[model samples]
Target: MNAPKLRWVLFTAAVTFLIAVLLTSFFKEIRKVDTLAATLDKRMEELVGEERKTQKLKQDISYYSTPEGISRLATEQFNLVRSGDRIYKIEVTSQDNLQ
Candidate 1:
């Protein structure tokens, strides 16, 4: 064919090849972006769950730090009696005596 025509054909083919390469790279970058976004969403969900647990634990700590709660815990858990309340002790002289 003519030189001018051949040059035009080569230029068109080169442009088409470049376009294809650019499209392929663009698609690969899009997939990477999608993967990154999904990962960020998953991490955000985990952070939200962790934040909720932290808030719940803080609330529990605040609840237990109250005077009434402390007193109740001391009374029931430690068997602490109020002031002037009497407690009796019973002792068995021998383990087999009652039997």
Candidate 2:
């Protein structure tokens, strides 16, 4: 019961199905790209955090390697007195120091 003019209808249906399949494949690729982008962003943030920690450690190392830092630590932390320097000790209780 098919007519000779039904070829056009079949061609249109085929084209529509191909376009639908192509659109679905394109969306899947987009989803994969989005997931990769999110993972990369997380990794970049982790790297930044590690870099910040590394920089802090480097600053700390630099500070400790200097003479002034060492001198300050020795003078403030330890009761060591150098030559030509006067040392004095004073103790104050919390209750008696109140103004």
Candidate 3:
């Protein structure tokens, strides 16, 4: 409890407190950066998925430009057939409708 000894002890305690404060702040900043990086990584994955879908749609559009692809789409969507194709029609009864 001498004056010189007391001064040295007080200085050491202050330095320790300052170091603790700086370390706490540094760790907090690092955690924030880690969280932001994770968020950015999730967004990048979503963008990659959208890019793949866009590429697939573009390929489909290109396929639709061809003559055979257009004919297939017309047959599927409009039920159109080529020349000399026969058509059959069926009548549905109320009992068959329930079944």
Candidate 1, residues 1-99, lDDT tens digits: the string is 646788899999999999999999999999999999999999999999999999999987897799977877888799998899788889769868868
Measured over all alpha carbons after superposition, the RMSD of each candidate to the real structure, in angstroms, is: 7.7, 5.0, 3.4
The candidate with the higher lDDT, 2 or 3, is 3
Candidate 3: Cα lDDT at 27 = 100
Q: Rank the candidates by lDDT, best first.
A: 3, 1, 2
Instruction: Quote each prediction's TM-score.
Output: 0.68, 0.63, 0.74
Query: Residue by residue across 33-90, what tens digits does model 2's lDDT show?
Result: 9999999999999999999999999997899789977877788788666689987778
- C-alpha lDDT (0 to 100) for residue 56 of candidate 3: 97
Sequence-dependent TM-score of model 3:
0.74
lDDT of each: 0.92, 0.90, 0.92
Clashes of 1: 0
Candidate 1 local Cα displacement, residue 14, angstroms? 0.6
How accurate locally is residue 92 in candidate 2, as Cα lDDT from 0 to 100? 65
Rank the models by TM-score, top first: 3, 1, 2
